[model samples]
Target: MAGVTAMTVQLNRMDRVSPWGFRLQGGRDFRMALSVKKVEPRSPADGQLHSGDAILAIDGYDASQMTHAQAQQMIRNSGNTLQLTVNKGLFQSLKPTGPIKFSPAAAYGYSHGHSTF
Candidate 1:
């Protein structure tokens, strides 16, 4: 947890049918991490949450091992009030490197792929 910083956010659902007003990124396939990708303007999470904030838990349940679908379901199931525990620094620490180009022949050493430099 060297780069992790945790904080809690509470969101109030205007009604049963209203949207959560935030978008998420990352999943088992992507990186086994969940992060806030977008916060709709003037929404409940607008000021409380931020893009790239890593979700550490939903309510009191751990979210580190959850898939995107599972996490979504958990949020949806949370009625009225939704409490989130997030790591504001975790996502920044996990930043992706620039695009890497590779050639099929590079594996066999037939041709050297472009260097990251």
Candidate 2:
């Protein structure tokens, strides 16, 4: 909590059927904390959340001590509009910088027009 900064984010179901357009990673294993791993471009969480932002709570429910599966389940049950309380700075040190390394085929696709960077 020392370096953490808490904030709330409200994400509405943009497509009405798709997932929240964000991926989460990390938990207690290997001493890792719960954090956002990715946010899809043009998605609801795209600009609202960032990779390495620690999930401190979900819909006002404490999430800092939750396991990956537990947190996933909570998100799944949050309905169309979800509220998330996150620690924006707590896990920023874990965020990756520069382009991510990919396999040759994937890299080619990304470099071309098949994927978004």
Candidate 3:
């Protein structure tokens, strides 16, 4: 018999540099993209990002086009501020304009939820 152990990190702004806490899951195929699986509370992603949010772009880096590792690296490299182009809903629809941007210096933190995944 074999056993597998998993650990979930409590994403905290003070703990992480980027503070954009979210689980990335996807990139299996063309149809499947690197999307948000879970958004942690008391973190940068808490209020802004929902569960189903297909991270179209992070600081202009396309998640749908890039591999999962690439997207993660981009997010980590974003530092304290992050500019995201996201599609929110059951089905992703690309809008011509309007992007969401958040900086660590802004009014944010604490825990809550409104998951769409």
Name the top TM-score candidate.
Answer: 1
Tens digit per residue, CA lDDT, model 2, 75-96:
8877788899988846643444
Hey, what RMSD does candidate 1 come out at?
A: 9.5
Alpha-carbon runs more than 4 Å astray in model 1: 1-4, 92-117
Clashes of 3: 0
Predicted candidate 1 versus true structure: per-residue lDDT over 1-117, tens digit per residue: 675668888999788587777877666534558888767877777788887788889998998888776777788888878899998845642443786477454566632211110
Looking at candidate 1, the ten consecutive residues that score lowest on lDDT are 108-117
TM-score of every prediction relative to native: 0.72, 0.70, 0.57
Candidate 1 C-alpha error for residue 41, in Å? 0.7
**Clashing pairs in model 3, backbone N/Cα/C closer than 3 A:** none
Clashing pairs in 2: none
The whole-model lDDT of each prediction reads 0.71, 0.70, 0.53
Which of 2 and 3 is ahead in lDDT? Answer: 2
Kindly list the per-residue Cα lDDT of model 3 for residues 1-117, writing each as its tens digit. Answer: 133222222223444444566666655333466556777777677877666665666676555677555565676766666667666533342222665475332345511111121
Instruction: Give the runs in model 3 whose Cα sits over 4 Å from its true position.
Output: 1-18, 28-31, 91-117
lDDT top scorer: 1
